[model samples]
Target chain A: MNKWEDNKAWFLILPVFIIVAFSAVIPLMTVVNYSVQDIFGPGQRFFIGIEWFKEVLSDGRLHEALWRQLLFSGLVLLIEMPLGIGIALLMPKKGWGSSACLVILALPLLIPWNVIGTIWIIFTRPDIGLFGAAINTLGLPFDHTASPFDAWVTVMLMEVWHWTPLVALLAYAGLRAIPEVYYQAAKIDGASSWAIFRYIQLPKMRGVLTIALLLRFMDSFLIYAEPFVLTGGGPGNSTTFLSIYLVKVAVGQFDLGPAAAFSLIYFLIVLLFCWLFYQALQAVGTGDKQ
Target chain B: MARIDLNEIRHSYKPSPKSDDDFALKRVHTTWEDGGAYALLGPSGCGKTTMLNIISGLLKPSHGQILYDGVDVSAMQPEERNIAQVFQFPVLYDTMTVYDNLAFPLRNRNVPASEVDARVRRIAETLELTNDLGKRAAGLSADAKQKISLGRGLVRSDVAAILFDEPLTVIDPHLKWELRRKLKEIHKEFGLTMIYVTHDQVEAMTFADKIVVMYEGEIVQTGTPEELFERPEHVFVGYFIGSPGMGFLECTLEGDIAHVNGAAIPLEPGYGVRASSLGSRFKLGIRPMYLGVHSSREACGELPGFEARVVGVEDQGFCRIVTVQFGGQEIKARINDGHPVAEGLCWLTFPPEKTKLYFNERLVG
Candidate 1:
C-alpha cells in the first residue's frame, strides 16, 4: 500500500520545465557560445579561449559603473525602507478612509516607468515647473540638466517617489496580519509606543520587509528605462549606471565577444548577491535555538 | 490588593441603543473584595469578556464609573490603572527569551535591571519555568508560552489585579488540571485579587471563591459554588452549573397545589399567593439526582408518584441516568450503578421540598 503509484504528478510540472528551458537556458547557451568565439562575420568565426572574459574583467569603465551601481542600490534601500514603514503606520486602519487612502497612495506605482521620467522632466523645469522654481526662489541653483549633483538628486528623488509605495503596501499587509490580542496585552503591560513598535510591529513585519528589500535591490540593479529617459547617460556619463554602460558597449560599439562576456558576468553578479541576501534573511528570521 | 466597585455600568455596541437587546452588557452593580478570587461564568457572547475588559481599563463603560479603592479610574488608560491581563491565546514576543518576556512589564515601567532580573527569576522559579528561562519564547510549545504570559502578570508586586480570560483553552486537558492547581497555590501565596472568565462550570467552581453567573448579558446570580448549585436564583443558573442540569416541567399552580398533566403535587403554602398571580407560564424544576424510581408497592405513598415509560438508560460507570416519559414530558433520573433498568411501568416520585416552583423562570419563595 505504501509503494508510490502516482506518475501523473510528473506531467503537471512538464510545462514549466519546457518553458524555462527555451526562455532562459537556450538563450543563456547562445550567450556562452558568443563569448567564446571571435566572429569576423556572419559565417566566419574562430575559437578564442577565455580571451573576452579576461579583457572584460580588466576594463576600467565596467569597474566604475559597477561601483556606481552598488552605491545607487544601497542608497535606494536606505531611504525607501524606513520611509515606507512610516507611511504605512500613518495610514488609517479602518472605514472608508482606509480605502480612500490606499487608492491615493497606490497611484504612483501604477504609472509607467518611462512616463514617470517624462513627468519629472517637465515637473522640474526651473522656469516652468513648480519644484525647480521653488528651490530657485529659495536662492539655490537647481538645474538638473547642467550640474552632476543636481542631476543625481533629481534622479534619486524620482526613484524614491516612484517605488516607495510598493514597500509601503507590502508593509501594510504585514501589519494587518498581526492579531489584536498582542496590542491589548502590550497596552495592559504598560509598554510605550516605541517599545511596541520595536518589539511587536517590527519583528512581525520581518518577512515582508525581506521581500521588499530583495525586490527593490533586484529592480534597481537592473534599472534601465527611467534613468535612460531622464539623463540619457548625461553630459559626461555622470549618472551612467551599469546597464547604461553595458548598452553602450553591446549596441553602440557592437563588440559582440566582449559585450556577451560582460552580459554573463553581470547576470552572475546579480544572481550571487541575491542568493547571499536570501541566506542572510532566512538566518535572521529563523533565529537560533537554545 | 484592591477592591473594585462597578457602579451602574451599561454598554452598547450601537451609538444609541433603542432597547435592552442592543446593549452587550446590562446595568451591573457589584464589587469584588480585595484578595478574593472570582470567576465570571457565562456562555459565548454573553458579555463576560466585555466585563473583564471594562474592569482592566481596556474598555470604558458607556455611562458608569469604575472605582478601585475609592478612587474613580473609569477615564484612566490601561497603563495608568496598573493592571495585568492574560488573553485566551498566548501573546508573547517571539524573539525574546522567556526571562525577557516575564520582565517586559516591569522593564517598561523603568524598573532597575537588577530588580527586574530578580523578580523575573523569582516568578520563573515559581511557575516551573526556570529551565526554559534562557530559551526563545517562540521555540516553546503553547502551554509554555501561556505560562510566560501568566508569569508577566505576576512579576509586578504592586499590580492592582490580574485578570485571566480563558488562559487554559489551548492547553492539554491533563496540564490544564495541573495549571489550575498551580493557580490556586499562587492565589493563596500572593493574595492578589484575580478575576477569571470562562465558559466551563467545573473550571469556575474549582478555581473561584465566588461565582458570578451571567446569561443573555444579565447578571443572574453571584454566590458560592454550593449556593449556586442548590438555590439557583434563576432557571439558567440551575441548568448552567450542573452535570446533566435540572429538569423543568410545565405546571399549573392553584392554591399551593402544582398540577402536572393530571396529577397534583403540594408545595409550600407561601407559594399559593405567588402562583395565583402568575400567568400561564409556570414550571416546577427538580434536579435529576433528586428524582427517585420505585416500584408501585414499595412506596410509602406520601409523595406524588406517576407511572412512567422508560425511554432509555445510559450506564455511566459509577452512576446511571434513566430517561423516562411522564406527565407528557421527559425527565432524567440519576440512580445508583446497580439499579435495575426496569422497562414498562415504573413509579417515579419527586420529593416535595426538593421540588421548586418557577414563575416566569424565577424561583418562588
Candidate 2:
C-alpha cells in the first residue's frame, strides 16, 4: 500500500536553525571576519590573512596566560570533583536535614560571580576582613593587593567557594538516583564500605561525574568575574588568567584582530579539553568493550 | 551452611507498634533446616520479603531473636553474617567485568588473588559466563546480568545461605526456566541452605523442597508441595497453592456431613465429632481438580451432589476450568478435555476423601 507522505515535516526544524544562526552562527562569523582583517576605523579595513592568528599564537604573554588557565582548570577539577563527591556522600540521605543541607550548599552558587568576589574581598581584607586580619594577627603578612601569592590564594579560594556547589549538586543527584538494592546486594556480598563506594557508588555516578567534570573544567577555564573583582589581576599578573588577559587585550588595549583570533583559539581549547575529558570518562565506564 | 531460626520474630515499620496490625510481620516463628531449599510463598506485602531480609540479617526484627546455628545474629550487620542475597532486579556493578563482579566479594574479604581468580573462574564456568567474563557487566543482556548477580553470590563458598527475592522477575520467560534450572543445580551441587521468596506458586513448588505460605503477615502453613496440595494446614494454603485454587463453602458440620445452604455434603468420618468438640461452624474446602462436575443427577449416580449453575467455561488448551455458582457462592471446577461438560446447569460432587474442613481460616485436624 502506498501512503501519502508530506515533506512539510522537515520545515519544523527551521525555527531552531534560525535561532541558532542568529545566536551563535552570526556572532561567530563576525568574530572570524574580525580575526582575519586589520581595521583602523568603521569603514577602513584591510584583509591581513592569518597575520593576527600568527601574532596571537606567538605572543609570550598569551602563552603564559594559556599555561595559567590550564593550571587553574586542572586544580579546579582536582579539588572540586573529589571534594564535591565527598560532601555529597556525607550529606543526609533524606529528611529535613537533607533539605537544609541542600539549601545551604546552593547558597554559594546562587550569589552572582562578581558579588561572590566582592564578598570574598571583604572577607579577606587585611585591615578589616576576618581571614586577612586573622592571618596578620597571627604574625603572617597577608595582603591580596600587595603580594602575588596572597592574590593567587584569595582568587583560588573565591573560585572554589563559588562553584564547588554545582559539582556537589550534580554528584548528589547521581548518588540519589541509585537504587537501594545495589547497596543491599553489596552488603550481603560482604563488601566493605570503601569497596561498596568504589564498585557500586562510584561506577553508578559515572555519567553525572563526567558532566560535572566537563562543566567545572569549562567554567573554571572561562572564569573572569570573581577573580577580576577579587584581585583585578593585580600583584603583577599572578592571577591574570586567559579570560582576564583576553579582556585586557580586547577592552584595555582595543586590539580587535588579535583579540578575535585569541577568542577563537580559546574556544577551540575549551572544546578540545572537554572532548578529551568526555572520552576518557566514557572509556573508564565502558572498560575493555570498545 | 546454617539452620536459620526465626524465634518468634516480629517486625513493624512504625516506630512504636502498639497493636498487631501495625506490624508488617505480626509473627514468624519457624526454622529453616540446613542444606534445605525453602520458598517463602505469599502474595505481595505478606511479609515474605521482611522474613527474607531478617534471615539475611539486613533487617532486625522488632521483637525476637534470629538464630543461626543456635547463635543469635539479630543485631549483626548483613556483611557480618555469612550470607548472600540477590534482589528482584539484577544488581551488578556497571563498570566491572563479569569476572571482577564475581571476584569482588572474595577480594573484599581479603582472599588471596590466586584463590579469587580460581573461584571466580569456576563460578563463571558454572553460570556459562566463561566466554563473557572479560566483558563489562553493563553491556550484557538482562539475563546475563542476572546470571552475573547470581555468580557473585555463588563465588563465596562459605556463605551460610543465599536468599533470592524473586530473582527471575526481570528475566524473559524462556530465560527464566534456564536460570531457575541453573539455581537448582547450584543448590544441589553446593548443598547450601537456600530461601527463595516469590508470589508465583509454580516457582515456589518447583524450586523449594518446602514451601512456607504466608498470608497477611502470618505463616499460615509450611509443608512440602504435595502436603500443601493434599493436606493444607490452613485455608489460605488451600486457596493459594493450586492452579485454579481450592473452592470454599461456608457450612456447619453434623455427623460426618457438612451442610451448605440446606444442602448436605459428606465428609470423612470423625470430622463431625472433631468439629463439634471444637464447637463452631466451619468451611468445606476442596480443590478444583477434585470437584467433579456432571450434567445430570443420573451422572452423579450413587454419590450425592449439589446443584449449581454453570457460569463460564474457560478452555486452557489441555483442560477446561468450569466456573459455577453453587450454594450462592462462585467456585471453579477443573475438568479434563476428555470429560463431558454440561451447559447452564450442572451437579458438583465433593469427593468425601478429597474434602477438607476449615475452622476460622485454619485446617480442622
Candidate 3:
C-alpha cells in the first residue's frame, strides 16, 4: 500500500474546515446570492441580474471613495514607515529600558479601534480637550467638527499615532536580528554611518519592511472605526473611507442587494492589491536570494 | 609598511580598578616589526581578542598609546587605521553576488574598474572561488561565504595589516587546512603584516612566525613557535601550546631537587634557585612527549621515579599515550608504538633535561 493511504488522518482537520466553511464560505455565498437579486423587504425579492453591478460601477461615489482611500493609505505609509524605523533605531539595544519602551509602544496597538477613535474624538474637541484648548489658546482656528481640511488632518494624525508603533516594533525585531559581526566588519571596511545604514541595515530589513508596508496599506485602505468616531465619515464626508461607506450602504440603508454587490467588489479590489503586493515581494525576495 | 608599537597599553572595564584583580587587561607593552606575521594564541575569555581589536582601532586603550610608524593612532577608527578584518563568521552582504561582495570595498575607495576586476579576480583565484563569482552570496554554503569574506579582506593590498579573528571556524575541516595554507601563501606573496587570533594551537603554530600567548589579558609569552614549544615562559603557555598539554604536578623546591609527595626528582641545573625570589607555590611541568617509561633495571640514578599503575592507553597511530598514576597524581606519558607496555604497574621517569620548574605560576628555568 502507498505510505499515505490512510484517509483517516483528514478527520483531524474536519472541525477547522467546518468552522471556516460556515464562517467564511457560507457568508460569502449568502452575499453572492443577495448580489444577484433585488430585496425590497423581508421575504420580498426579485432577480435583478447584473443591474446592481452596473449601477455600482457608474456610481462615481465609489471612484471618489477609492481615490480618498488610496491617498489616505499612501499618506499613512509614507509617514509611518520612516518615523517607525527612526524610533526603532533610537531605541536602546538591551536593558530594562527596552522592556519599558516595548510596553509603552504596545499599549496603543492593544487599544480597541473604536476606543481609539473615541479617545481621539474627545481629545480633539476644541472646547474641552487639552490639545484643542491648547490650539485654540494659540489663537488658531482648529475645529475638526466643521472644517473638512481639519477633519482630514485629525484623522491622519490619529491613524499615525495609533499605528506607527506596529511598524516600529517590526522594524526593531528586524534590526535586532542582525548580528554584531556585520557592524564590526563594516567598521573595519571604513563604511561611513550613512553607508552602513544604506547598505547593511536597509538590506537586512527588506523582509520586515515589505510586510509592514502591505499590512499598513490594507488596514489604512479599509480604515473605518477610528475615522468614524473622530469625524463620523467626516465633516461633509471628507474623511469617509471605503469600509464606512460600505457599512452605511449595508446597514443604514439596508439595501442588501447593492451592499452585497459593493462588498464583493471591495473584496475583489483588496484581493487584487494583495496579490500584486505578494508578487512584488516575491520578486524582491527571490532576486535577493539569487 | 609600518612598525606598530603598543606602549604600556592597559584597559579595565570597571570604573575603578582598586587592585590588580580589577584589570581586565594588565599593562602590556610590545612592538611588532613591519611586515611580520603574529598570532595571538590563548583560551577563550583570555584577552587575545581584546588586544587584536585594540590594534585594529576598534577599542581605545585605558592608558598609553598605539603608534603606527611613530604616528599616534590610538584614537583613530578602524578604517582610518587602514586594517582589514575577517570575523569568526562570514559577514558578507547577503543580497549581493560574490563578485559584488568583493567589489564593495574597492568601489568605496573609488578604485578604477580595470584594477578592481584584476584584484578581485586574483584573490578569487587564490581562494579557489572563481567559478562561483557570479552567484549570489546567500545561496552559497557557510564555508563558501567565509572564503568570500577572506577574499574581500585580501583583495585590498593597501591595508596596513590584515587581522583574522578565527576566520576558519565556519570552514569545513578539510577546507580549513587548504585555506590556512592559502593564507600562508598569500602572506608570502603579498608580504602584508598579519595578526591572526585563535584558540587552536595547531593553526597558530603553523601560521604565525611569532606566537604571542596571552593569559588573563596579559602577554604571558611572545616568541617564535620553536621558542614557545621548547621554552614556555608561563605555566599557562606550557599548558596551552602542546597537544595532550603539558602535565603539571605540585612540588616543593629543595635545593637542586624538586620533591613531589616525598619523592625526590632531579631537575635541570639552575631551576629551583632561579625562582627562589618569586613565591612559595611550586610545581614541575613536563610535556607528555618527553616523559618516558623505563624498566626498574634500566633506571640510571637514585633520583625519584614512580612505579605507576596504568589507567588507560590511547593508540594515536604514530605513538601511544599511556595514562599512569604517579605519586597520587594522574599523568600522561607518550611512548613509541614499538615500546612494550601493558595495563598494569609500569616504571616512569621524568628526564631532567626535559623538565621545567614553576614558582608562583611563573616559569623558573
Clashes of each: 0, 0, 0
- Measured against the true two-chain complex, the DockQ scores of the candidates, in the order shown, are 0.68, 0.65, 0.50
lDDT of 2 by residue, B239-312 (tens): 88898899898888889989998899999998877778786689899999999899998889778968899999
The CA lDDT at A114 in model 3 is 93
lDDT of 1 by residue, B155-263 (tens): 9988888899999999889988888888888899989999999999999999999999988878889999998888788899878888788888889887888888987
Between candidates 2 and 3, the one scoring higher on DockQ is: 2
lDDT (0 to 1) per candidate: 0.88, 0.90, 0.86
lDDT of 1 at B272: 83
Error of 1 at A238 (Å): 1.3
Off by over 4 Å in 2: A1-7, B277-280
| lDDT measured at residue B312 in model 3 versus the true structure, 0 to 100 | 89
**Which residues of candidate 1, in runs, are more than 4 Å off?**
A1-9, B274-280, B300-302
Docking class of 1: medium
Q: Candidate 1, DockQ to 2 decimals?
A: 0.68
Off by over 4 Å in 3: A1-8, A41-51, A94-104, A122-143, A288-290, B15-22, B278-281, B299-307
Which ten-residue region of model 3 chain B has the weakest summed lDDT? Answer: B295-304
- Top of the candidates by lDDT: 2
